[model samples]
Target: MRKFRKDNLVVEIYENRIEMGNSAAEDIADKIKELLAQKDEVRMIFAAAPSQDDMTSNLVKISGIDWNRVIAFHMDEYIGLPRDAEQRFGNYLKKRIFELLPFKEIHYIDNGESDPERICTDYLKKLNEASIDIICMGIGENGHIAFNDPPVADFNDSKLVKIVKLDDVCRQQQVNDGCFKSIEEVPKEAITLTIPVFKRAHNLFCVVPGITKAKAVKRTLEGKISTECPATIIREHHSAKLFLDQDSASLLK
Candidate 1:
């Protein structure tokens, strides 16, 4: 593994996604342990994607974490998927980590809500109830963090969560991840936690792997911080660590 710092962000490159995931999960587990020592509960937000599979799987295997004192929340969910659809972000996280661990609370963004705005307001209330301690996230193939695609991301976003229209590249990525059969099958709209929400988190652990993310990873580390590549914003975060595998870091100079 190799490590470096870019502004306030720490970057770690590992031999493969498995190694990267293991290190990231270990670091997060340590953080959780540390926080639990200081407080009664630890609140975290998670990103659901195939890219996070290794990390989430490893996280559940690690001992010493008091899962009973952890409160869980997912970062985004599709706007129109059926209640039981496997493609829904909530369901994805449910299978990945939510059910694997016994968390104190698990707040899912209801994708089947009849009113998007109403659900956003409701979720915002839940988020604001306490300060978020950590965010486990990933960069999209288009350099988006969460579902805040370039076109919709706002660094100074006023809302904690809101609805967004998925850009072409973002929709295509769902297909590339095998979450949907085709771009047409992907939901064009989603409810996502805004950039400001991530900025407010105490720590951010962004795990991004795979060759398909090379360009996005390059942009996030080397490009000027801008919404054009929303992930670039992490460079300014005070306690953010980006974990990458060789294939994902291939385009980095």
Candidate 2:
């Protein structure tokens, strides 16, 4: 692994996406063991995206994780999409990770609810009721974290979860990732856990791969810590670690 640091953030780069994923999966699996030893249960948050594919796949293969002692949750979900839309973040995760492992429970944001505000509050309560031990996430092509794109990210956001309009760059990225055939097909809005929620997690394992993410990776490691490039906030979290493939880390100094 090629390794480096940006302020408090630790960055690891591997030759290929698979290797990067394996390394992250090993570390997280070990961390889960450490946490479960002291607590009856653990809470984890996940980001659902193509970037997380390799990591989640390898994570499920690791032996000895007491998945029964874990409660799983995802960070964001599109609003106003058809109830059966295959592009929904929850369904993406269900196919990639949730169904691959057996966790005690899985909580997904109900994006189709008639009252988005009320559901956000209900999810916020669930987040506050437990201390999140792990956050498995990724940086977007536009440098967003979850759906907290530049325009909506707040370092001191008052609410744990909120509904917000998706910025153009963010919506277009879905098309680039093949989640949607066109930008018009992507949901214009989403419900997401705010920056403060990510900061509160005891450990943050960020998996960002592909050439498409090179610019965002560079800004995340070299830019000023600000919401303009929301992923830059990772530099402020001492517990956060970034995993990248050579393609993504290529532009970083």
Candidate 3:
């Protein structure tokens, strides 16, 4: 692994996605162990995506995490997918990791709620109820963190959770990632945890892989800190670390 710092962001580049995932899982496992030693429970937010496959799989296989004492929350969910829809971020994580573990509790955004306002209010309450310790995330091909795409991202958003319209680039990414068969199949709206909500977490880990992300990764490191490229904010975060594979880091200077 090649490790370096860009401002306050820690960057670790690996030979392949597998290696990057393994290293990220190891760092997260070690951090969880350390946090568990000091507290009775640890609250963590997880990002659901093909990008996180290697990391979450490796994390679940690590033996010492004591999943029984950990609380899991996902960062965002599509606005209208059915409760059990495979594309729903919550259900996506459920099939891949949550069901495999014994978490203290898992909180999911009720995007199925008829009144979107109520869902956002309830989720915000739960989030503000405690301090979030760890966040495992990914940068979208469009440089979005979670679903905070450029058009809707706000660094000082007052509401922790809110609904936002998905941008064309963001919608196309779902198809590119194979989450949807085409852009039309993708939801045009989503209920996302605003950028401010993500900032509440104490430690953040962004794992990005593949050449598709090479441009976004490069912009994150070199662009101005603006919502034009929301991922750029990661560079200003004191406890944020970005893990990248050679392909994803190919465009980085």
Candidate 4:
């Protein structure tokens, strides 16, 4: 593994899946334990995607982490999807993590059956009131972070959450991940946590795997800091780390 710092952010790149997942999960559990040692309650943000499967699974199995004292928040949700919908990101988290563990509170972006702007406003208000201790995320094959795809990504964006149209690359990635049967089946719009909100977390753990992510991973790590490759802006944060399996880090120098 290779470790470095860009500003205040700490980035770590690992060689393969087993090591990457194990180390990332331990690091996350350790951070959570540290926060609980300091206070009664801790807040966190989670990303829902296949890239996070190993880390999330390992995280729930770690003992003495006080799952009940954590308040969980999610990163994004597809607009207009029902809570019960198979494609719902909220439902994904509920099944994969939240339902298995107890949390003091779990706040999800309710993009179903509400005016998009109003939902964003309400979610933003909730975020502003809570100070997030840790955030777990993944880098997209398109170099997108959260739902912040290229054309729409805004580094200086001030909104906490907003509706965004899915770009072609982002849509195809969903198809590739088996989240949808095809690009046509994927939702066109989503409500996403803005870059500013992601940057606010005290610690960020970015887990990226698969050979398909190799090119984007290389760009995010080696390219100029810009909205084009949204995840590249991690360089701007002080406490972010990137965990990559060999497949994803293959293209890196």
* Candidate maximizing lDDT: 1
Best by TM-score: 1
Q: Which has the higher lDDT value, candidate number 3 or candidate number 4? A: 3
| Model 1 lDDT tens row, 119-227 | 9999999999999999999999999999999988999998889999999999999999998898889988999999999998999999999999999999999999999
Considering only N, C-alpha and C atoms within 3 Å, which residue pairs clash in candidate 4?
Answer: 8-238, 9-238
Candidate 2 worst ten-residue window by lDDT: 105-114
What C-alpha lDDT values do all the predictions have?
Answer: 0.95, 0.91, 0.91, 0.87
Residue-wise lDDT of candidate 4 within 1-253, one digit each (tens)? 8887655557677777878888999999999999999999898999999999889988888999998899999999887566688778889998899899999899988845468888888888888886889999999988998999999999889677899998999999999999988888888999999898777778989999899999998898889889889999887787888888889988988
Q: Which residue pairs of candidate 1 clash?
A: none
TM-score of each candidate structure, all chains considered together? 0.99, 0.98, 0.98, 0.95
lDDT of 3 by residue, 175-217 (tens): 9999999999899888888888667688999999999999999
lDDT leaderboard ranking:
1, 2, 3, 4
Show the lowest summed lDDT stretch of 10 residues, model 1.
107-116
Candidate 1 at 21: error in angstroms?
0.7
